[model samples]
Every structure is written in structure tokens, then in C-alpha cells.
Target: MKNIFKLSILGLGLALTLASCSPEDPIGSKVTYYPLITVNGDDFMSVEEGGTFNDPGAVATIGDEEVPVTTTYEGRFRGQTYNSTLGTSVADLYTASYAATNEDGFDGVATRTIYVGNTGDLVTSIEGLYRSTVTRNGALTAQYTDMEYVLIWKNSDGTYEISDAFGGYYDLGRAYGVGYITPGGVIVANDIPTNNFSFPGTQYNSGFGAPSEITAMTVDPATNSIDLTVVWTTTTTYTFQIHLDQVQL
Candidate 1:
């Protein structure tokens, strides 16, 4: 009986010892890992007008394992018709959005800007003389009448001269400016020097300045006509729609 009692005590002690040495439950202390997603390839791309855009695709990963990801794309472009007058092609700007999502609910998004331009020189394509008309609609609409007969001279060196001949005659002494066309088919006008000039009968000088801006320009090669939008600001902003026909110099 004593031997059996000792065996029972030994077994109980062994059980308690095993219980103490065993690992604790780690449910609350476990760390959860999440998958990461990334887009692959250039964030900016360019294509010719009506050209095909090939997607380079993307990848996702969790630790050393590559996870499968789904991708989607969205695109936007200005719907301008091709110009036939000048035999020049109209350039268009397009933006594409790429998105990737992993099974772990993690996602990534990337954007690319595409410029569809003609194969011609950007500088030579925009050089010419243009006639502009101004219209006002916001805040100070009725305070001014439509101004006509504005002139723009786009020179070969990417420099331009503007004459705000409000009543069919040049006034403000022609403000000199510089500008460039982007690969994405956008025209950016840089700041022109501020000029102080007096009207024909005025004794005091009035200050005239040009605003830096990005405007839309379309070329029609067939008609030799270029359509452009110019935004000018002084005390208030004025938008001018210009139709430039290459004056047979």
C-alpha cells in the first residue's frame, strides 16, 4: 500500500511538472502579417494619337511569396478633332490610372500621363500670327464689352509678342513674352515683362502685364488654321479664343 501511495504521488508531481514546463497559449500574442502591393513600370508614358497603349502590369508580395493581384485601368482625353488646314496634327493629352489589389485587401494605385502629339517639331508647329477676341462672363460680366482684333505673333524662337488692340488698333505697345509646348501637347505661356505705356491722348502711363498659363491649342493642317485658348488676368481674369490663319506672308 505504501509503494502504491508513493507511485500515485510521483505521477501527480510529474503531471504538475509537465504542466508547468509546457508552452503558454499564444493566441493573443500572435502577430498578423499583411500583404503589400506595388505597381511596376514607368509612372509616365507617351503614345502617338490613336496609338495602342500596352500595360506593363504590376506585382504583389507577402514575405518571400509573390501573391496574385488584379489590375484595372482608367483613361481620359480631350476629344478634339484633327486639324486638316495646316497639314499639322493636333496633339492630345491623356491620363491613365492603374490600380492593383491583393487578396489580403491591400491595394495600390498609380497614374500615368500620356501625350499624343504629331511627329513634327513642337516649336515650328505653333509659330504664326493669330487673331483673338475676348469675352467676359464672371463677376464683372456687364462692366465690359467684347474686345476684338487682338493680335499674337508667335516667333520662331518660342518667344511671342501680343498687341491688345482693343478697337482694331494696337495699344499697350506690344508686350513681349516666352512660352513652350510640352510633350503632352499642352502649351504653357510664361510671364511677359510688364510694360508701361500711355494711350494716344493720355498723359499718364498705364501698366500692362501678361499672365503665365497653360492653354489648349489645336492645329488643322488642311485648313492651315490653328485654334487656341488664352487666359489673361489683370484686376480680373479674361479668356480669349483665338483663330489663327497663317497670313500668307
Candidate 2:
């Protein structure tokens, strides 16, 4: 009976080991590897407004073997849609995406961003009311929150206008005058969003200087947020950054 029990335990262990074993692949079977996609040119391209654009496509590969890549593009240019056409008129933002599929039904994808505009113009669309966050010297400055409120939109004359040029930091008087009065604003700001011919900010008034100048402005592509920096006689040393988040378009 003791010998029989030992033999039974050994047989169970062997059975478990056999069940856990993986079957070997047939001879000459190929191993599957996912494709790696690499874009050909610059990930971001700056094409002039109303200029001709030719897309330099991307490439995909599995190990050293090259695979066929399928490419598609979508752009924002005066509400125009073109997936294969090369003409780009007016200021626009385009995303060209490349995709490849392997035999095992695995897909690899990559994209390129194209900004179409003339030099020194707003690249992407920013015409709308914005939820603004003003930061001075890396610290949140909420005092001028009211005056810092900004609105930007297009005009019939094909120009742009901003509510406040300073973006924020003045107009310490939302209620009554305490520190300073609201500074006057800019009338003719920049180009239109369609032609990259204009500016930012469509409403409100803030800042100490009578005319707050927008020294620099840019949009962060990743967050789809616009950042504006303003400087004036009162705040000449450093400028406050107003991060504009779109509230209404």
C-alpha cells in the first residue's frame, strides 16, 4: 500500500508537468513582429499661407522588411476638406496620419502636424471666448482675473481684435478703483484666422500701461492652448503668461 501511494503521487506530478509543457512550433514557421512606423520629414511643417503643399509620406517596417503604408490627411483651412489634394489656401492646421498593418492583424500608426500660415501669424484657430489662467513669474496671479478675461474673434474688414492687449495684470478695479484703472485696449490687432493675417483677444480691458503690447504669443499643440505674453512700462522687466483655454468657439 505504501509503494502504491508513492507511485500514484509520482504519476500525478508527471501528468501536471506534461500539461504545462508548450508544443513546439512547426519547422520553418515565421515569428511575427509588429511594424515600426517612422515619418519621413519634419513632424511639424510650416507651409506659407495660400501656398502649394506636397506631403512627404511616411514609412513602416517590420524588422528590416519594409511594409506598405497607408496615409491620410485632415486639415482645417477655411472649412475646406482635402485628403489627397495638394493645394493649401489660407491659414490652416493639418494632420497627416500614416498606418500599416501586419499579417497578424497588428497595426502601427504615426502622424505629422502641418501648420500653414505666413510668417509671424497665428497658426491655429483661436477665435472664441477663453477660460484664462494668468501666471506671473511662475505664480498664479488671480488679482487681475476679471480684467484679464479675454475674447478674440474676426471682424468683417478681415482683421482681428483683442479685448485686452495686456492679457492681464492691471484693471485692479473690477468693483471700484483701488490700485489702478483699466488700460485702454487695441483696436486693430492682427490678421484673420483664415489668412493668418491677424491677432488674439477680442474683449475686456486690463493692465497699467495705456496700451499693453503683446510681445509674444504662441499655441501649444499638445494641449491645444494658446499662450500670450504682454509687456508694458509698468511691467517692463518680465511679462505675465496668460494660458487661454477655449470656453466657447
Q: Write the per-residue lDDT of candidate 2 for residues 1-249, one digit (tens) a residue.
A: 999999999999999999889688777877888989999888877566567777788889998999998877675323445555545663445677788999899899998877655432234444544456666656664465534235555445645444445453443314333233323333343432433333333222332334445656665544555677765444345456777765421
Candidate 2 weakest lDDT stretch, 10 residues: 198-207
Q: Per-residue alpha-carbon lDDT of model 1 for 1-249, expressed as tens digits?
A: 999999999999999999999998776554434555565677655455445656565565666677665543322222342211111132333444444455555565555554443332222443333333323232223212222222343334454333332211113112221111111122323422111111111111123443423245555655655455555455776654545454332
* Model 2 CA deviation exceeding 4 Å by range: 1-30, 75-81, 85-87, 120-157, 161-249
Best by TM-score: 2
Q: Model 1: runs farther than 4 Å from truth?
A: 1-35, 76-96, 117-119, 122-249
- The C-alpha TM-scores of every prediction are 0.33, 0.42
Error of 2 at 88 (Å): 1.8
Q: What CA RMSD would candidate 1 show?
A: 16.9
